[model samples]
Target: MPVEARYALLYSDYEVTPCLRIPFEKFAFLILTLPLCAFIFCIIYSVLFHFESATSTHCHVYNVLPSISAAIGNFSPQREVWQTAIMLQSVPRFYIAVIYLQFHHAMAYPRDAWMGNFAFLLNVTENISLIILSFWTSSRHYTVHEKAFITFILMSEFHMLLTCIMQSRFKRHNRRSLKWKRRLFLTNVSCIILGAYCYMRHNSLCEPYMYSLFAFAEYVVVLTNMAFHTTAYFDFENKDFVLYKYGAAITER
Candidate 1:
């Protein structure tokens, strides 16, 4: 019998519940694609509006890359587009949090289980802080926005570190999984280095060049995160999960 058919036969009394217990790969794909699409749309909109030329002064032509925040903030013509991107990205962020939480719960390793929980906490914190920072633009709530931005960055880095540690543990246990984990670790390191360089050069004397670098670095950061989650597809590809309602009895398959 097929796996699904056999499982169905074993639990004839149970009805399949409609829930978000989707395949890890599918969930990860959505998490990666949605934000990417949103950012691409925001970038195109910003360019079409000539946001930089509109804001440039006598001697200073604003570079669009470093000015992403400014482009999305109150004064920019593409503020609405930026906010829309934020809103769209928030959906994937929420999905990622839930998916990872479920992933960790399902694969509860006795020794390093807490690492997964900690990573999930940081992930949630980063996403919440990002949403808060996006809505409370620096123009109106500068202090609050700055705090949220700093919190988001800190949490994101810590989350990535924890995830790397977790993947390392997996690699030690299952040699077959090492390939993706190795790639993920490299990507994480690259994100950290690029992020540091972007930070150091953000407001330097060569503003335009630094801003462009910052923009590209930020894109790499996002792509690195997408790659990290994409590895989960391989990690959990063969595992099957059956979720039960609260207080309902679960029969082991």
Candidate 2:
């Protein structure tokens, strides 16, 4: 029997009336848009009012734009706004990660399910790391923030790569979602490389706008990461999140 068939059979005894139903695409859109807007707002706020503080580096020179850490981690309204946006999105993202795990398990072979599970673990870890880094600013708790940031980056990259590999193994999966995910993943990798290079050169030579270029690269990395996740919208476009009351089954003689 197929996975869906088995799932239906196992739950046939329960009374499954949806108390709440939400389309995954809309959920995805709201969550992604929140952070994007927050990021932009923080950047603008930093540039407009806190220009010297936002753009100042350890070398006491000003870049064109602030690094994400400086923009959202060091300021007043920016920090609060960023924290709020991330907090709002975090729960939904966790739910989505669980849904993706179930999706992979249902669609993939038994042996391949392990990869899905690992990817799911990575996704959860990445989310947790985001929370840690977001709440613990580098300026305040440098050690915690630095560690969380590193973990978030590592987990995110691995999770995306594994998700793509797992989906590619399925011949009948959504080609459009897979294609776009692969492209976004490549873009993210490119941004990472560019960001690293710019960061290195900035520290070594403190060239004009070098740190700004690194900051811009970091922005692209974030955008691409979010875009890659938004592909989940296509994957689960037709799906609805249904909630059922427990122990509500009825039988008539």
Give each model a TM-score: 0.70, 0.90
User: Candidate 1 clashing pairs?
Assistant: none
- The Cα RMSD of model 1 versus the native structure comes to 5.9
Q: lDDT tens digits, residues 1-253, model 2?
A: 5333322211333565645556657667888999999999999999999999889987766678999999999999999999999999998788677767777877788879899899999999999999999999988999999999999999999999999999998646899999999999989989999999999999999888999999999999999988988998777767554434531111111
Superposed Cα deviation of residue 173, candidate 2 (Å): 1.5
Model 1 worst lDDT window (10 residues): 244-253
Candidate 2 CA-lDDT value: 0.83
Clashing pairs in 2: none
* lDDT digits (tens) for residues 37-58 of candidate 1: 7556655665667566433433
Highest TM-score against the true fold, candidate:
2
What local lDDT score does residue 184 receive in model 2, on the 0 to 100 scale? 92
